[model samples]
Target: MFSPFDSILAFKTAIYFFLRSLLKGFLRRATGLCELQRLCYANNIGAKRTKGVEKSILLSRCPVLKRINTQLDALAEADELANNWSTVEEAVEATMVAKQINKSIHEAFIQPYRICLVQIYGYRQLIVRLDQIRGIAFDHNNEVHLVLLKNLWKLLCPDTELEGMISKQWTDIGFQGQDPSTDFRGMGLLSLENLVFFATVYTDHARNILSHSLHPIHGYPFAAVGINITHMALSLIKAGYLKTHLYNVESRIYTVEDFHKIYSYLFASFDKLWIRSKPNSVMEFSHIRDKFEAAVVKKLQFEDAVFRWDPYLETI
Candidate 1:
């Protein structure tokens, strides 16, 4: 399947990497610092610095360093929780030993490298936590799940009393049918968690957005669109597209709460965009959703990107 041009290009790429590695080695000996340390010193604190360190670590030939990265990823995949700080400390010490980095001379690299590790592994842990929550299907038989479902209703519609466990009132808040459980199929409890967090934490904003969703002409299914936004957030996180925003904003460990914040922001932003565009009906949701996602992805391509919900900006 390989054409002559393709073979030539592959050979050229290989030679380029080989020469680049040799150059890095020569520079390391001359500067008396590893690639990571040099990068840490060159770049300021934030996404650029952290991303540089991450790249250096991933490209490292050191077995211990590679194993540490593998182990962190494996921990997330297995849904095994561990103390992030302790893990970072062990990884830093192990990486130093593997690279023969002198602690006395390279003490400056410690904090920055540690921060990068925290962000790196913290992201993995966040993915694990999200997957664990998303895996739990909403159960009507479960008391806790029922309580959460009721709580969401109470937060959104305080004056309205539920007619029953399953009723048309559910449709008032955007459920497709009398039974709201079916709407949570793909996203599972993660969707519910995101919705509840937005309503509970940002009551006024959530209400305003809900009001927008009820627009007679442009009305859309509130809960359904929220679940769709949750899916988008999860996709962005898993695809590593959120790293620029996360790295710039969170110096510490990332959590499920952080993810909820992201989802809420997306939901609110989507509401604003929806109103501005003034679609004839809810039928345009798929196109608008894709447009919104593309915009978010574009914003996240910048190293300085940090998304936060501002109450003042929510006025529409």
Candidate 2:
């Protein structure tokens, strides 16, 4: 498995980074600015600046800089959401002090660097909140869960009345069985929340996508596929594959609402792709889903990728 060419390429890459680090250190000494300050002052605002700041923090050897992220993680684990900004401000001050940079002279670097820190750490906080929600299994007996489930049905099927809680009519909306509770095992309440958000916020688009799922020949399980899309979105976020897109799209702090928007986009895009593929049957879902996911991942690899829902595309 270890070819000579592969070994040589790896060695070259390592040396390149080592030399680059040395150059950066020399430049910092000459310019009297830390790597983060230099990046903030040099790069344009938005994704490019944010991404550079993230990489700088990840690669920094300074103990204070390194502990900044660790402290943020600890705060998130303790559910200290209110103190995230204060913590970030403290870290920025500590970083300035550690590098012995006078904030009075380089006031411009403060806001840009702070904004990037907010985006970076805010993303981590969002992941923690999402994980907490995803861990909650669907409970049929819970009043709030029952209300959400019923609300989903009413939003999708306004005229149809439920025969009972376990009626076969549940399949009309694409639940695999009369009782939809069993389907929420993997993603838990997150799946339901995504579906409700899509239906309630983007009612027309949601209905249109649902109609496509009812296609006689190419019909797929709407609810199940939506849950799968939720899982895909979460996986990408956790893997840092969504950083570029989120950094570009979300100027403010990231939230569950942003995650839901991503899910809606994926679900709509999947529907469009599925129709274009003209599959022989629903059995081909796995193949088509893999191809769609690969395409999405490729798109997200770029520094400026921002996914948006195209309502007009539904007609195409």
Candidate 3:
């Protein structure tokens, strides 16, 4: 049924298709192997060429490829056999140049890790400093600290001058005892600093809160409450909870100022909470303090939380 010429043409057509399919498959494998080698080099796996018969077949495609391979091989081994460390120091010069190139590669590799390390180191250093601050005793003889404290008291009570440590104004501000230093036992000088910062920076709001401490049935000890708020702030910092409010990924940590801000916010927030809660008596202080702390912790859990002046307090 078929002519001999037609049979010969069909055989040639089938051979053509077979060669084309083989070539397509070989090209795909070659492309994939090249990609794989590049990936290995990128990940520092080290690149090595195939040897023996495979090496000859691999580089047979283009003359440019063979030349590049020869140059690269020569450069890779140049440091091994060279000893130009005499008067000229040519080998030393070559080594330095290689190191310069290698340094850039090393920096590229370790940059992310270095950033992570700096962040972790900065955080740990902040915590250590916080701990150190909390452990410091309120020095009675430190004239500067004493002057700061006096200024704070004066700012709060411009009309009444607190002459001695055992003044009734001390009780008016809510110290637990005649000497305010006795109450600083738990929080050390840090609590005093918080009080001074709040009193000095936010004078009107501080005075308003001081006035609210005189509420007939629900009066709370203002200074004692401030110290407790400082404790809360420190606890949050130590537990890493304050990072949500105190830090951003790329921002520097302002540990002292941030803590002072928290203290001020606590005072303002507590005053508002106290007015709303309308507690029966001063005996309810612990219950109110706990409720206020819970509220603070809840707000700080939010991703974008920041302790700031209350809108109403700012107006005052």
Candidates arranged by TM-score, highest first: 1, 2, 3
Per-residue lDDT tens digits of candidate 3, residues 1-316? 8999999999998897677557645854775323222222343211121111123223234353344334333432342111221312332223224323243443342333222222323444565666676788877788876776688679888998788855666877888877787788898888988899998888888898888888888778888888888888788777766665554323332356667777787778888889888988878878988898888788767656666565453631
Worst 10-residue lDDT window for candidate 1 reads 76-85
Clashing pairs in 2: none
- For candidate 2, what is the TM-score? 0.91
Candidates ranked, most accurate by lDDT first: 1, 2, 3
Off by over 4 Å in 3: 1-120, 310-316
How many Å off is the CA of 257 in candidate 3? 1.4
lDDT of 1 by residue, 1-316 (tens): 9999999999998897798799899998999888888888888778888888788778777788889889777766665535445666888898888778999988998998888887887787898889989999999999988988998899999988888879999999999999999999999999999999999998888888888889899989999999999999999999998888889988887889999989988999899899889999999999999999999999998888888767667542
Judged by lDDT relative to the true structure, which candidate is superior, 1 or 3? 1
The global C-alpha lDDT for each of the candidates, from Candidate 1 onward, is 0.87, 0.86, 0.62
The candidate that wins on lDDT is: 1
TM-score of 1: 0.93
lDDT score for residue 73 of model 2 = 68
